[model samples]
Target: MTVTVDEKRCIACGMCAYAAPEVFRIVGSASTVVAQPEGKSPRVRDAANGCPVNAIRVEG
Candidate 1:
């Protein structure tokens, strides 16, 4: 799976990184995913869903 962050919608709240530090980070006022969500780990998906602005997108 792949995780993409919508910079436009990102508020730099750092929720994604907080939820899944392995998969996400706050960089230059934006949220970025450093790892791929290939396994069954729900961290990435959870972060996406937890985003208040819906800035994260996950694709398998």
Candidate 2:
């Protein structure tokens, strides 16, 4: 699985980073995930769902 972040929809809440620091980080004022490491999709997706603004996406 792969994850994608809709930067435009982000609210800088930092929930994703808090939920999964290894997969997500605060870049400037938004959250982002390193989606190319092969086995982090579930963590990223969980982070996304944990976001209050719903700013993340997961794709297989």
Candidate with top lDDT is: 1
Model 1: per-residue Cα lDDT over 1-60, one tens digit each? 788998988999998898889888899989887878667668888888899999899887
Summing lDDT over every window of 10 consecutive residues in candidate 1, give the lowest-scoring window: 32-41
Q: Return the top candidate by TM-score.
A: 1
Question: Model 2, 21-43: lDDT tens per residue?
Answer: 77777898777775444765566
For every model shown, what is its TM-score relative to the native structure? 0.89, 0.75
* Model 2 segments more than 4 A misplaced: 35-37
Worst 10 residues of 2 by lDDT: 34-43
